[model samples]
Target: MRRDIGGVVRNSLLAGAALLAGCAGTVNAPYPPIRADLSPAALARGATIFHASCEACHRGGDAETVSGAPLRELPSYMGRFHASNLTSHPTAGIGSATDAELARAIRYAVSRDGRLMVMPSYGMGDADLAAVLGFMRSGHPLFAPDSRPAPRSEFSFIGGMGFRVITGNEPVERPASGIPVPPKAATREYGRYMAHDVYDCASCHTDGYSPRKTEGDDVFAGGMAFVDPEGRKVHSSNITFHETGLAHWTLEDFTRAVRDGIAPDGSVLRSPMPRFRGLDAVEAQALYDYLRSVPARDNEVKGARPRLTATSVRPAWVAATGAETTVQGTTVGAPPEGSATAPGHGPQQNNVASTTSQGPAGGTATAARPPSPGNASDGDGVTAPASPAAAQGSSVNTAAAPARKPRPAAPKVDAPKLFVQLGCASCHGPGARYQDRLAGVANRSEAELVRWVRNPEQFLPGTPMPTYAELIDEPTARALVRWVKAGGPASLSSTSR
Candidate 1:
């Protein structure tokens, strides 16, 4: 090969310049100039909003990955990924971010370098965004004093590289400032604000979120799937006023379901369902009103109950930790030894389980809040605290140690008759089959079935299926599981009314 010395030198210099440009690209630019209110009332409102919206994910929400770590260390995808800290700590949190920078992060998910952070762009009015910034500015760091880089896998950096290349790290365009907010009323306009900005109901209930998602799609026709800690699938119910949705539900029914986690059908919502007990009365009413106002889409989603029972399989990330730190899912760390649940915190709060589907025991459910609107640090996609009743269900097993020998098996029972009588067919309905829906049940021993039927929530912390202990005798429940595994002898005549 002939050496072109001058050409090589010229190319080297160009390469160096390119490298410098790349490095500079990662440096976040100063935020655009903007003024914001920092009044105490605004700050207090921000705090309340934080607790209602941001606290689930950032405040030690992921018990496995972010546990024992500072709140600044936000967890995403369980503990595998995380968002930048929002606390007012110069080193670890968004303390250095300018007010405009913070706004951009929330409204656009862009970093100082104009890099896209995995955040949702909330279509919030300016006042609401300003309040969030004010709250963040006044807030002190609650967890870590020093900042920590988010945990990463080998491909994480590569993924980031791809994102920057694709997005070009363009800063998010700011929305109009000083826009008027809807008055806190039960009117549809205010209800829209509460639903989209305050409680973020549409983000959870609908499909994918984008700048244009709200304008185009049928909002609140729920189809999101939330997996419980025990690996059961509970699809977000259709809240639209369609027959397959919440057409029959009253406003009172909606309130009880959101505030209490109890469905009108008498079933308890599974874990990861944050029963917003602290939701303001007005806000709750507004949300209900907004849901009713939206056009109903008849999306017939099923598996609104515990269907999957996974076998013991640990996650790959868990191998590094050794011990199987199961919380909601394959958690990487344990909660601080005396880490008590925050007062008024739901059962789903601080259950640091990982959401990854892989690892030693297939990735189990982990708790993390979804991103909040106009609040970059807030929101874990699966935000919802378990209800008080669901929380109590978790401790039932801890009180007693199990006997080594399994209990006596139940006698063979008729499943077809039992299924009809107990209304199992009601939710499972006509077309549903045990072969596809029922998981991990056929293999469970009679003793196991006895424990499960008696109190599924006790064994599986967030299962939505009500306990059958009261409905059926232990022997019958055991026999029922056995018969279900064998394939119910009688097929349903029609869908349960």
Candidate 2:
């Protein structure tokens, strides 16, 4: 009887083991299918959605960014992360994945292998999700065929646990069917969809992910800064239709700025401000309408640094001479030896950058105050004039001096600082180990440099470099071009390597 009992127990254990093995084999099988519409209209809609949402990261052209995981292995975070090429190429792409598998990946961030994916769920509408699937099946492939499996993530055990805890495997519920996006008319409603859902403009423009917060009305207030490859700091402009925001920008101005990269004043926009290839005039108009409709905030944004001019020298002179006097309309003292200025060209009247409230007419223009003698003596750099005697007998070259011919205004921009601020040095300067140093760029002509910055794609089609046609004014762009032509950050060093 005891021998019979042992045999039964052994058989039970073997049967349990076999069941577990069978369950393990199903881990990579396609998940249950979700209803997906694959009509031509859906595919077309998907193409536009992909361009606005996924192409920026997954298009396998420009260097991959961290925000959108590249569909192919590319440089990121001192290493590399990759997303599968969602194309019809066998072995190298997701052509082999079943509709069920693709749907699961999009809906729940669950891969075919049952591992959690890092792709963010953008709360896609049901039609949008279906459209994306259709697009993957029929759209043109971006990368060449390769059979290697997408690399496994190097996430730590703790990280895996945290991700599982926070983002559970529950699939996102699809919106009710047939609720497609409204017509692409230049209406405020469509504009809202394009801005908040498709382009994610608020993601970059606002201070952090405030859109997801309860106090999310701060969207488009614009406090974000993008450090360019050169180390230039590019602050996002406030798009709110307020005095401190886009109060001066008309719909046409916004359209031109986004599409042509030409600002209202005809300045060049800095890099990382990519031109949306497929964002058409209609879409741009719609976006503009939506921006106008949003709540206006009075957040003042610091845009590109003011371009260097003759007037830019006043603050430095005041600090250096340390003595103030009313020497007529001239700079109180000679610039310290080896300064960039010529003999008599003193700080002009409008040397101090200031903004005055002229109601809606001025539109919050940036204006500078001319450094005055009384204000100079008061140390605030602005005040009513003091007696001429107070100005004449000052320590910086006292007594009546000969009226020297005005020297040419010194270049006020520090090339190194400008190089970093313009983000040129970050990608092309001394520290850019992965890229070629810009020492040779100093050889390009000013016109060529300006042209390149204004529109690099015109010269090199499909190039990853961005255009600065709207982010920088002519003078600032000229200064930067001159610096690049003069060997950039390395020019400051005594020795060249």
TM-score, candidate number 1: 0.49
lDDT of every model, 2 decimals: 0.51, 0.51
Query: In model 2, which regions exceed 4 Å deviation?
Result: 1-51, 59-92, 103-110, 113-116, 123-135, 138-141, 148-150, 154-173, 204-215, 222-238, 243-245, 260-274, 298-426, 433-464, 467-497
The per-prediction tally of clashing pairs is: 27, 31
Tens digits of per-residue lDDT, candidate 1, 1-497, equal 34698889888777655543452365343443444558887776665555455555444432312112222222222223454555555655665778887776666666665655555555567777777777666633343333554342121333444444544555434453555678878788888887777667776677543434455566787766555433455566667777777766667556756664555443456445554544567877888777887888978778553221223221122122223223112232322323332233322322223333333323343322233332232011223455465556644554477554221222223456546544466445455433245556667676776566545544433233454432333334555666666666335565441
Off by over 4 Å in 1: 1-36, 61-80, 140-146, 152-176, 225-234, 265-268, 271-277, 305-497
Residue-wise C-alpha lDDT for candidate 2, range 1-497, written one tens digit per residue = 99999999988767655543332232232343445557989877776666545654544434321112333221132123466555455665676788777767765556677765555444455667778777766644433344555554443333333333443334344432333566778888888876765566775677642224313878888776655444556677778887777766767567756665544443435545545545677898899888888899877777642232323221211222323211111222222233332222233311321233231111222233334434332222214465676667655654588874332222233446545533455456554632353555656776676667656655643334544443332333456677666655665432211
lDDT of 2: 0.51
